[model samples]
Target: MCGFWRRYFFLKTLRGLRVLAYSPVTRPTIVPFDDFVLQEMMYAYKHPDTIKTDDEWIRWIFRLRRRERRHALEFVEGWSGTRIAIAGTTPWLASCLVGIIWSAARGNIQTAFTVAGFILTSSTVILAVLAIISSVESSNRAVT
Candidate 1:
């Protein structure tokens, strides 16, 4: 009898917590997946440089092989750095999103407010470094 009463009281307390935590709000607006996909496809197709025909793909493949040969001959080619910048940005964006969600769940207004700013700052710094490196490389090529 004592064990059963203890368990019942614990469950009742948990039920009260659920009631206290209840948030009654209207449903959030959701974007239709089809419409979102359509928008992305349209945007990608609208870019002339990104749109590829079969012949264009073949030509691009050949061009890539030619560039590879040239790089081998030169032996001075270096990293593109775009991938590095993108890598840095990817984690920052993911962290910012997670932080936002965490702060929302915990109701931490300060954390939610500052997380995005910090992420943006790091992203900007990474992009700036990548841009400076690329620009220096381009300038060196022009000088040589």
Candidate 2:
């Protein structure tokens, strides 16, 4: 009787699994940007001839409303300086950790400190570059 019940339960579980495997996956619909500046950017991206020069692109963004200008600046920063800084520094940071670990494991405390200091100095330089980029971006926004 117990063996028969086990077979029955197994068949029920298999049928349930088969039903789940055949079910269609439902993905969330991705909605496009509704903002005027973002929509214009999309159109310009699709039709490159619309804005021909860097000056034209800058001027176009400068002409937008204050909120729109801020949004455009943020979007540009996300794709450019800020993104580059984080992506470039992340690997250096990971390597810094590994170097510190390796040196400490080898009982070379001084070497570990040296490696940490050098990487940290480079990180500071990268941070300075990021600061300059952000300041320039802010100045551009201020000019309009």
Candidate 3:
């Protein structure tokens, strides 16, 4: 209610004045959102579901009052699909790595061995990380 109603009811305002003891909060003038935030809002609008990420689960724990839960499990499901698609194209990366390693093999045996070891370790580590990402995304889909 406005100040007049507040005075009529002897609320937090002064005894007989148009003064408000508390001032209203000012609205923020600007909001900045990244791609992730926009994608998440779109996911909620398109395919609502429980966002079952670990961080989101923690948020649910500290919620003050029960509000609507917009289920957006498709968010993670689509992410898993994208990860699988990326993993499927990993052969391209593998071929490039192999070419580099092959070129590195023109030197002495010890040099070739060390270079080969490093390239294989690094490239395979990338692939391994992709696999782990795929697995985690898939699990998130299942949980959500």
What residue pairs clash in candidate 2, if any at all?
Answer: none
**Candidate 1 or 2, higher TM-score?**
2
| lDDT to native, each model | 0.48, 0.51, 0.45
Q: Which ranges in model 1 have alpha carbons more than 4 Å from their true place?
A: 1-92
The C-alpha stretches of model 3 lying farther than 4 A from their native spots are: 1-107
Candidate 3 local lDDT, 1-144, one digit each (tens): 235522232212111111112123432122234667556555544444656564763574345223432222122222344444554455555655555676666645566555556666676677677556645645664562
Q: What lDDT does candidate 1 reach at residue 101?
A: 89
- How does each model score on TM-score? 0.34, 0.35, 0.29
Note the clash tally of each candidate.
Answer: 0, 0, 4
Candidate 2 global TM-score: 0.35
Q: Could you give candidate 1's per-residue lDDT for residues 14-46 as a string of tens digits?
A: 111000111134322332336555454445434
Model 1: lDDT equals 0.48
RMSD of each: 27.2, 24.5, 22.6
Off by over 4 Å in 2: 1-107
